[model samples]
Target: MGSLTRLIVFLSIFAAITLKSNSEYLLPITKHEPTNQFYTTFNIGSSTKSPVNLLLDLGTNLTWLNCRKLKSLSSLRLVTCQSSTCKSIPGNGCEGKSCLYKQQNPLGQNPVVTGRVVQDRASISTTDGGKFLSQVSVPRFTFSCAGEKTLEGLPPPVAGVLALSPGSSSFTKQVTSAFNVIPKFSLCLPSSGTGRFYIAGIHYFIPPFNDSSSSIPMTLTPIRGTDSGDYLILVQSIYVGGTPLKLNPDLLNGGAKLSTVVHYVLQTDIYNALAQSFTLKAKAMGISKVPSVAPFKHCFDARTVEKNLTGPNVPVIEIGLPGRIGELKWGFYGANTVVKVKETVMCLAFIDGGKKPENLMVIGTHQLQDHMLEFDFSGTVLAFSESLLLHNTSCSTWTSQK
Candidate 1:
């Protein structure tokens, strides 16, 4: 049998050996207090375990946790430079007798988080309500330990991060490798209801999403280069009210060049183009007195827009992918797209991604509030479907024109 088949057979036996009687486990995720950052609680260590809140990041790879005052620090098994796991992880080297790992931000915009690599016993709630599932113990898992110092951009109280990227050091790769299962997972974040993060075998699916008829299918474009880790999708053209904007041809190419990175920040050039096109069309349709808001160049009068959140006269923004795959549309009524910044001022949430060559276009997470995105690593595809729950308070109560 092939290696993948052999591994699957091995996991079937291991599951019985471990007495973990379940085909899947769900990690309940919640929004960070006062912020949109998504986080989940993890209980790590051995005898004296402690719970820590970690940010769920798709852009990052390695999972790092604060180990400054971890009560079970003594129980961690430090990986040496000679180990195979150390070699698999990039930027790993021997410091005296310790195996140290480093992930430096190519851009100086963010601080570098670095530390030694070690394995420990960790636990996580496997239910939607954060109920502890005794069978799911992450034994002998490798991760980074961020001592007392604070990491750049990481806010207070949020201990560290749980990276869900496809990179070598990512948590998903480690988990699947340890259990000998196919490396695949899915995330479903609703606008108001509970969200679920899943790590399962080849045919990974949440309860309701198992039906094939309930999902919209699309191909995932692999991002080339050693630096590309997050799920990046291809774009054929972008249109504002059916009118195509002149975008760089290289960005829309079929082969593995950079398409947009799916994240929370949008590159300046792309955002500027969309905002300019949308704003110009709005003014021409009888919306009077156009004014610019700092940070967000495209904004309208809050008082006038309050009466009509439908963004009447404003065109629907559509991003088209080749092969008639599908178009991602943004109507004016969604959560963060059109937000009220002040009592009298409301602005578009899209912001400039500063001057950076690699600051390529990114699809903000807020845009996926009412959408279900599936990242199928085994098939190399990204599937998307509109959420079943349509009546979101932050969004327009009227039926969407999807």
Candidate 2:
């Protein structure tokens, strides 16, 4: 063989090998968000009632309570846990349980830390969209660590793990249900790597999805943690949007998909929700039944998804924490919802208020490669008025003495 020919062949082989390796590291999952959403955290039992100033997961399902820790609660204050507004006393940690806790996690499992309304800090994302809008929450809550139970060493200092039947644990039910809908997964919350908060968009705002949406049925599977026992969601797929991604069975062999959806489940609550941005497509999907513990026994669909969302261009600005990391810079958005792109419903996200996430947004999982992301801490079901039974709230001043 000629030298030049041989050299060309050798280089071609080398390039092929390199590209293959890179592909494994960053496989492309569709960019659109397919399902509703998920959270991360579990339960917070009777542990130290002291206020913890750590980050929290908005979708947490921790069991909550109003304790005697806050001695200064005024009668006029209608509280379920502790504080009224989170922005005012973002780091006070005095609130034990309040209405905010109940409003978010409908399951009533979230240990009521002092919940409060966040002061709005509007930031512009799109100027032409008219009024650029976006802001961070103020007066976040502080959980009490005193009088809390300590089981697994891995439990968030404030959110202690809770154990019991699925009916008893909020996370257990949600995680299991989510697992049944999708394939199982090993959640990756690499803080040391990403150095940012978790990303959850669709899960928080309950971004409007398919009109016929229904919860995936699943059961809780118990596992041991560094501290004590925790639950994991045994689902069918771990998808970016609609495609089912394989799970690290080794990591979750015995673990559960802690009640919260994967996004908001975090050690602390950052400025973002618990979801990623992407465009999903389902083609030639199938379904099989698995054990009761296994979420679903089938693969329902294999289709593609690439669509956007619009409502008379209401032009409402939505706020979100970072979604995915690219080039080492964190990104934020005012409104990160769905956008129709070439007949597909993809997750539309904004880029630091630069690119409108709603502009027929479409993303691919390969874009999320080599990045660190986390979700919420616990799976606290918020008690919305419409869904009151799942959750109940009364912000009005009540006389529930500690």
Candidate 3:
């Protein structure tokens, strides 16, 4: 079958599976009280009730918990060299017959510190009608306990990391193995309101796509390489309204043989290029008196417009893909790309990655708001759809498809 046919068939087959209780298992994903990192809170340990707050990281494997206080807990046991789980973890020091993990900085800083691995009971609460209700607990949840120090890039109140990326140690894989659900999940980040994270299957906001007209279809692009934790996809072209930006496709790839990742942090050069192109187009489209905002390179005066104006009338940004799949278009008010920074100004939300890698071009959470992003690791493709926030009341009644 063709790719489209194959996707429909796969979704149909997976959707048919009767969940033990409910077709979908839910989790309460919070911003960790409004920080850059999104988090999912869970309780760890067996009778001791050690609460662990883990950062929901799509860029790393190995769910980790800070064990500084609970290092002596009876539930926390070091994985021996003879165990299969120990072999799945990367790193050395196995001669001691204990699983050791060393934190490596992406910027090539020296190894920060190493931690001992352990498996303990972890439980997360579920939501009903948008309110957190009860808990679904899991025993023998594989994670590492911070040994010498707390996990890097996280501070107190934030205890450990929740791995959502592919691999044996990731939470997604472990959850899938334990539950036998489809090895996939969906996330819908809203521009203004609280967003949601679905562990496995659809959020019930998007109606099951039966035909083309009822729902929009997006192209599924494969992520490149094995070791990288990024969700990389192929970008065919980018257009502002009807005008295509004059960007060298190779520049998006950072002159490396590696694939392009839809990054949360937009690299400096790429952002500069996009901002320049957008400014040129906006100026030509009668935004002659553009205002410069601090941070965001592109901004518009909000004085002359309505006080509660949704946003600027920026032209639609279209992202194209290879084959007959389909294009993703960001409308003036739909995609939530335009933001009101101050009472008198509205600016674009694309942030600068500064010195970050050019190949790390990502679809940040800001851009992902008001959209449903589905990752099918079993199929090795990323599927995206416009969220029902613009139409439906809530995702409560939408079909929870695989």
Candidate 4:
């Protein structure tokens, strides 16, 4: 109740948070190589008319377009609750309620598609990278194919329904399902400056790039779940100055937080919190109470890497925890980095367009040769120590407290 009493309470809480009972370490190395790039194109029937340079996203199998952003199709119709020609995707007859064009909701009642031809309104969705939000133009425009060939076992578009069920009977469900059917794929965006692939690889002769510049292109790890957990970038662990590392709350991948969780990267890592806001206010769904980092800013390095550290055969990223676990490279102190308890994970930082980059994490042979996998289980609490546990060599690569 008093000032001194309040200070004591605060200290007690802080102690509870900082205390470490036990810690774990994940494999510190990873492997990577070249792979193919995946792309998708939509054409009317069997014509050479590729409209949208749509990226093939098994995560979004349903082929669609920015309904209003189309180049004026010959005949396109917008389905409505009240339209004589409106019809369900056939067979999906209404139980009691009904409509002429009953294709079910593609984006659901609050469908991801909503834009009036007359009023150009777009929907906002945080992109997969968690870097920024995108306002997708919408007017619900799917090309009116006169006669389009459907996927092998699929049917063609009839009235309003296109056999383009995106794979599954349900429209939106297909996207995620397709991606799941094939977990990993690669695309070459040499222009975008990203190169690294697990299975599919990439097509770009893209100059090897890194998170910012200090390192080379780090593969985009994907984590799977439902819509809410869909667009996650599941990185095994990050790096700093050639060492496995952790990102502080202030410099968290999701640019710290905003008013609410614009996306999961913005999702707070209570276990990984470094600095608390003075206001002590809880953040919104996709937001953090901490300060924000520069937008779209990445790390950079102008100096050449040490040859020994960048040598081949050395596992840069090791898999599994310590002990007799599935480790990639041999275990050695000062040789292969033995993640210490409460150590800091290096980040991908870049200075102004002026000099050599400092403090960057390079994805060496370990990340390249080995696989960036995801278990049905892993601790959600990521911290300096959590980074260690992630490289646990058979769960025994950890500091046990008894």
Stretches > 4 Å off in candidate 1: 1-22, 105-110, 127-135, 190-194, 201-228, 251-264, 284-290, 306-314, 323-333, 354-356, 387-402
lDDT of 1 at 190: 40
The TM-score ranking, best first, is 1, 3, 4, 2
lDDT of 3 by residue, 1-402 (tens): 699999999887767655532434566455533444455655777877776666666655686666864534877767886788887865534548787765442211234445677888776654432334466666778777654345544534566667776666778777767667677766655444345566665333344433435554444555442564555666666666666667767655532122111213566766776677776766666654356676677786655333223335665565555433565443333235566668777766667768566454666655655566677877876776644444543222333211
lDDT, candidate 1, 136-216, per-residue tens:
667877888865553445546567777677687787666666655445666655444346566652232343334445333
TM-score-better candidate, 2 vs 3 = 3
Q: Which regions of candidate 3 are displaced past 4 Å?
A: 1-23, 32-34, 68-72, 92-95, 104-113, 125-134, 147-156, 202-225, 253-264, 284-294, 304-312, 323-335, 352-360, 392-402
Q: State candidate 3's TM-score.
A: 0.75
RMSD of each: 6.6, 25.1, 8.0, 22.7
- Across 312-397, the per-residue lDDT of candidate 2 in tens digits comes to 11112221111123111122211222232322222332222122221111111212112222222233211111110111211111
Tell me the spans in candidate 4 whose CA falls farther than 4 Å from its real position: 1-41, 45-50, 55-63, 67-112, 115-186, 191-223, 229-242, 246-402
- lDDT (C-alpha) at residue 29 in model 1: 59
Output the TM-score of candidate 4. Answer: 0.29
- Candidate 1 has its poorest 10 consecutive residues by lDDT at 393-402
Model 4 has a clash total of 76
Q: Count clashes in each candidate, considering only residues at least 3 apart in sequence or on different chains.
A: 0, 155, 6, 76
lDDT of 2: 0.24
Better of 1 and 4 by lDDT: 1
lDDT of 4 by residue, 177-243 (tens): 3222222222221111222221211111112211333222232222233322222222333322224
lDDT value for model 3: 0.58
TM-score per candidate: 0.77, 0.21, 0.75, 0.29
